[model samples]
Target chain A: MLRTQQLEYTYPGNKTITFPDIQCEKGSQWLLLGQSGTGKTTLLHLLGGIRKPQKGKVYVADQELNTLSSTALDQFRGKNIGIVFQQSYFVQALTVGENLQLAQTLAGHSADSDRIKDLLSRLNIGNKIHDRTNRLSQGEQQRVAIARALVNSPGLILADEPTSALDDENCKEVIDLLETQAKEEGATLVIVTHDSRLKAFFDHKIILQ
Target chain B: MNPLTLSWKNQKDRPLQMLLTLLLFGLGVGLIALLISLNTQLDEKFKNNLAGIDLVIGAKGSPLQMILSSMYHIDAPTGNISINEVKPFLNPKHPLIKLAVPLSLGDSYKTFRIIGTTHEYVDSIFRGTVASGKRWEDLYEVTIGANVANKTNLKIGDQFHSSHGFTDDGINTHDHGDGFKVVGILNKTNTVLDQLILTNTQSVWAVHDHEAEEKQAPAEAVAADDHDHDQDHASEAAGQEDHAGHDHSGHDHADHEGHDHDTHDHADHQAAGPVMKPLIEYPDKDITTLLILYRNRTSYQTLSMPRNINENTDLQAASPAIEMNRLFSMMGVGTDALRNLALIIVIVSGLSIFISLFSSLKDRKYELALMRVMGASRSYLFFLIILEGLLFAILGYLLGLLLSHGGMALLSGYLEEAYQYEFSGWRFFKEELWLLGGSLGIGFVAALIPAFQAYRTDISETLTTY
Candidate 1:
């Protein structure tokens, strides 16, 4: 349901960083590996409508987010695109339950209590849901962010080096969760990472130097 | 529970800022309530002075001043008039003129204005029914209004001295006498009478050691003149009733003017009072003001006050209603300005709320983006910022209103007693409600800008670099 053709975006405020084209489609697990300053994040931002591509278009469900009003784009992004930051940032004052509730609220839906309980239980965070997000470890917080992203069942999932803070075992657990959860939700998962360890989780890979 | 609960949770995220906003709202609203309560109290105390009396007769000057001095214990008398003006109207024949109670005011008891008149004035004008004791037994004996008795703590048979001028700080000695017996104490009227000492006109003249008839009697002539004119007009209006044999009317008219004046000339007029023999009937001077109660509403210009004052008659007239309206308009501008300033402050507060919510969003953009990627909508993000603003504004408004009410309650009395004003605590007018709505509106107003920012955040960019 989501695809981008010849999506070109340029990094601002630099004479040397050039625009690049990217193409992607839904229902596929894709890996975008780029060296430092290769515009991987820029491309992702453009795809998410955080920054518009200087040229080309991104179509989600056959509709262009670029063509929609700024307000509509936010709603569209909130409901259909979930991004996981390398360093997870949750609202500090809120408990885990509240953090997820915020995500659901931002997506313009009430928190589904039953679905939330099941998701937390599945993610092994059922007990942590009522605890303050700040009290959780980096790995735990990352899981919370992931749960928040998946709460609305968006069609596209974006993860940016999400496993950087976790050890080898927790990293595997997180990666597996993303892959399996995306498959279950019928979502296209795109992970941006420089780590070779995560390469095996996806079927297709694009490496940038 | 609603989205705004987050701001409440995050209050310490900007602790000083939150406290400052609360303080600003509280202080601003408190000042407003303070000024309002003070004004109300002053108005109340002033109102007490004008309470109960139907009319005021005086030499025409400022109606406000006359009311202030005669009805209230503030300001000085414009001058006095010969009572001949309202005397003719005091005719028992005139169905309308109930009692032409003449009031002569020149001296003051302490800071309270001393009213010199007959027992009729003591009964009707002062409305004192011997709360503690008997009526004035002799010249120089007096009945004190409620506030006066309270301030001095004088009871029946007590004697108190008077002061010369209307201000307590004045150096002049009491001209009326060394001491006047407290023959009567009046209940509190909460009006000008509260600050007065009432005595018979003969006593007033006695203090000056003047023959009573020469100075006091002619003051009634002023009311008589107006009384007679009104009677002539009434007679003309009733001319059609001539066939009904107006002999009763004619007899009443003659007796009305004839008996009172002629009776005083007689030795044993029991209604005259204890010192009636020495009251030394001058029989002409009337009260300081004629409280002209007309059937139709009359304008100040039409009150014949200017004509009375113009002949250098030492008399001026004033309309209480006109002066009061003027006072209200004059005060309204100041109040409106203050309220507007309050509104502007609220708006500024709202803008600060917007800045706080919007700028804070920059740091939280990544989390927001993640949520968006996870099936959250742009509207959801927008609501987060707006709700934050809503949270801040409403909290401020509630606290401000509470502070306002508390301040009013504390200042109500000081405003009334000290400033000659009136104030009611816990009493809110419609204007205060408007203030609340306007204050709360600031949140929404500030929200519009930040909502724009949220709608524009890039979910992809907000996520951290790999």
Candidate 2:
């Protein structure tokens, strides 16, 4: 459900980084691996339509990201592309359940507390639904972030270095939770991380240089 | 979820800054509001108390003082004027004079003035009625004013001595054997008369008959003085020395029967044993001031009468309208300056809001970017900042408006007691609408810069800025 072709980008007065094409089918998990300077975050940002790629096309669910107007792209991204940032950034004022509800609202879907609670229960953080995200443990925050990403049942879920901050046991658990949630939603999961420890979890992989 | 809820959370997140901003804004709004309310109410009281008399004739002194004293009774009388000196205006047949009410001052009970004038002073000047008892008929009998009766707790048939001068505490008390009896009390007329004790001019002469004896020289004055002296002697014989003992009980039985029976009984007691002859006549004697009304205020008399009195006679005549205009002009300088300063403070409060919002916007960039990513439009974030500002404005305005009215109510109570002019605290002025608009405008202008910054928040950059 996601594709990219020769996607490249550049910062002001900085060197250009060309990315290899990415192809993924629905209900699949893929890892985009790179070192710190290899544009792993940049590629994920481009695929989420957060930035305009300078050279090539990014396609999610058959819609080209660059062809849409800025406003339309934002709407399309909210509906189809759910992104989990490296560090979980929640609107700290809202509880975890409210954060998930916000994701549904921003995605133009009506609020579904049952679906949100069910997702949290499956993620093993259901009791923490009413707790502020800041008060949650790191592993629980990561699980809540995954619940927010899958709350709208988006076709594509993009996670940027989400497991890099976890230890070995938490990392494996987070990756398993992500793949399980993605497969349950039949979504294409793309994780961009510099941590090669995640290499065993997915077969489809692209290495950025 | 919504912009309003988000903005509220944003404000609640920073309680100290919001409170400081609201206080500064409230203080500015409160000062301007208090000044506006006071200025409007004081102007209303001053205009209401003018009472339509055209000219005030008194001894030569400051025209404003004479106007304030003779017309408003808020200052000491310039000095006494002999009634003979103003006989031209006092004459009923005078061409320019419609009516002249002579006033004799220099005595008071507590803060209230005891004014000695004819019945025309009450009927014509105040246009009032006796709320209880009858108008004074005997020389020592007096009519208490509504405010005087209320403030001093004096009832009909209650006799009280009026000390010399206008001391508020009634110091340097008079030693005259018999004090003036409260024979009648006038209803509230909302004029200067409400703060006065009304008695006939002869009562004033009789009470100060000793002074009249000291200044006796003119033939007509000596005749009037003798009449007052004879009346004083008769009142003394009628047991004036026992009046204090009778009133020492604090409540008098004389007024319980609807009229002053005690004074009539004293008169009858003198008449039963010895024949006391009533005086033949009271000449147009000395008075402290004359309040003159024009026959036609729109005619040339409005201009020429005061000029004619000032240039042609020994008495000084001042038009109330002209003197009041001068007083307003003098007061306007200070009030206008204060009003302008309040406006500056309002502007500074706006700047404080701007600084507060602008600084907080820097800290909120990541949160704003998150909202943008969560499908909040650029305009939504902009409105969030604007809504926060308007919330502060609305809160400050409501509190400030309350503060001003509360302050005015307290101030009006003190002023009403000190100067018998009533000021209503519940009244609202149309200018307050402009004040509200100005405060909102300040909030809007203050928030514009921060809201603009919020609108331009770069989502990807801010999200990644950490």
Candidate 3:
């Protein structure tokens, strides 16, 4: 579960972005929508504990993120939060499976190959597990990124414009994979994107202005 | 995966850079390792072979040459000292002298020198035992040293004609209807004796001057004569044994002084060539050198005797210890320069690694940030860069070590074949450990700035901006 209240952040140039209160229950799919310059990425970072808000009560898995030390926040984030970016950027030198395993390792969890294989099989990229991430097709790489996010069974999954680079068919397939995978892993999914096509996929929406 | 696997994958992502780093670092490490091994071994060999005799009295020439030629048997003899000229020190009645072993050098069986001396030289000075058969019982009966027998494949009873010069490939030959007979062989002694053919002084003279007709005494009679002569000298030498005993113990104490002063014991292996044949009295006889053992290492006679011989006699007295040090210092300058140059190469290689890592950081920032978002701490990212650096250094060191040994083995082969000199490539040096640590230190230092940069990478800025 993830929730944020009256989060306010200021950039170095004195620009401020005020966010609305947010809530996402377990296993629910939600979208954070905004036009360009609305600070959707800033809000995503704030919720993920990667950035500290100027003033806010940010909670993830029933714990106040800002109250934890940097090291503890890193540990807490690793164990409970998974993030997918706009573009698939796996460590290019590693295999698809290795990239997923890296997520588990960095999260301070033992590698679970069966979980990884099962996740990949659900995404139809299980056969490409040993293939280098850089050698995979764009669609397959996106699928691997999704697998990496869900490998640790995190409570919160934040996807920042994950399907923005894909064509219509690939965008639909990737979005479906992310939603279905997050549902299967029982994680609350929050996607921040400018893509209007994603509006129909999720019922819960928070539009940032 | 683990950090190591990640480091390896990172290296693989940039193969050219990785190879360049390895070669640069490897060459630097290889050259230094090779130098240390060579310097250690050469220094040991030079030090290990400089003991026993106090003076090397040979014909007037370079004292280093005299020592090298007669004592080490590595250079051409410095002309020849006549028996009459060297007779004062050789006399059993001489008060300051304890033992004088005469060496006659001119001929060779292959590369080994054919040395003619008295039986006392072999039995007393060298303390040698015949591995097979008996000591020479007749003229031209030669006792082969262990190395000579092994290299030339000569056996007892195998007769071999001597060449005219010291070289094995010399064109001039000695065929006087008499070839030297290998009547016996000496065991390996790890001294100059291992590379010589031993016979009586008369055998060398007879080989050079075939026209001299010599009256031959019965074998038993000559043996009896040498036995009488050795006994007379033994009794006379016994009266001076107290000083000699002190000299022996004093030399042992001097060993702990330093490696430069450690005296290698050279037990003289004498030939005696069937002392049955009477030797023509010394007057015009030209022997290569005379090795003298003093009654005491520090006796007033030992110090004054060399100066006395050099000033009063035609023969020059050379001290092995002094000449060898001069040789080492002279050789040291060139090798030290080479060693310093290798050190510079290692440093330059470290810089190259630094530049490569620094340049790669720009391209790797996005991936690093992704790792951070995946929950890797800043410290983990910092260590990843450092690990990559250490991996480069370790791989380079391993390759460099192999290159150095391979190069040394090649050089050792050439030296063995050309100069009969042994340079072992198998010896491990303590400096190698230092070299390893040095390489790792360089790697760590070179990666410092890049690793710090990785630690400071703002994950949110990198991820959002990209």
After TM-score superposition, the amount by which residue B205's alpha carbon in candidate 3 deviates from its true location, in angstroms, is 1.8
TM-score of chain A of 3: 0.97
TM-score of each: 0.65, 0.82, 0.87
Which stretch of 10 consecutive residues in model 1 chain B shows the poorest summed lDDT?
Answer: B242-251
- Specify the highest-TM-score model's number: 3
| Clash list (residue pairs), candidate 3 | B121-B270, B122-B270, B125-B268, B126-B267, B126-B268
lDDT, candidate 2, B287-342, per-residue tens: 77888888888887566778887898877899888998999899999989988887
Residues B24-134 of candidate 3 have per-residue lDDT tens digits of 999999999998988887666656555467778877877887787677777666566666777677777788878888887767778687888877667766677889877
Worst 10 residues of 1 chain A by lDDT: A14-23
Candidate 1 lDDT over B1-466, as tens digits, reads: 2456765776556688778876675556555555565566566664554544545656555666666655554555545555455554355454444555556665565656677766665566546566777666666778887877777787778876655435565544443334677888776665565557888765554443222222235554555643543354344323332212111222223434543433432333234456554222353433455554432335553455435544645445455666666777888899888867865666567667777777776666665665565444677667767776666667776777678777677766665455443456787766566656766677677777776777666665555443
Q: What does the lDDT come to for candidate 2?
A: 0.77
Query: Candidate 1, after superposition: displacement of residue A46 in Å?
Result: 5.7
Best by lDDT: 3
Say which prediction, candidate 2 or candidate 3, comes out ahead on lDDT: 3
Model 3: CA > 4 A from native = B118-130, B134-137, B211-273, B276-280
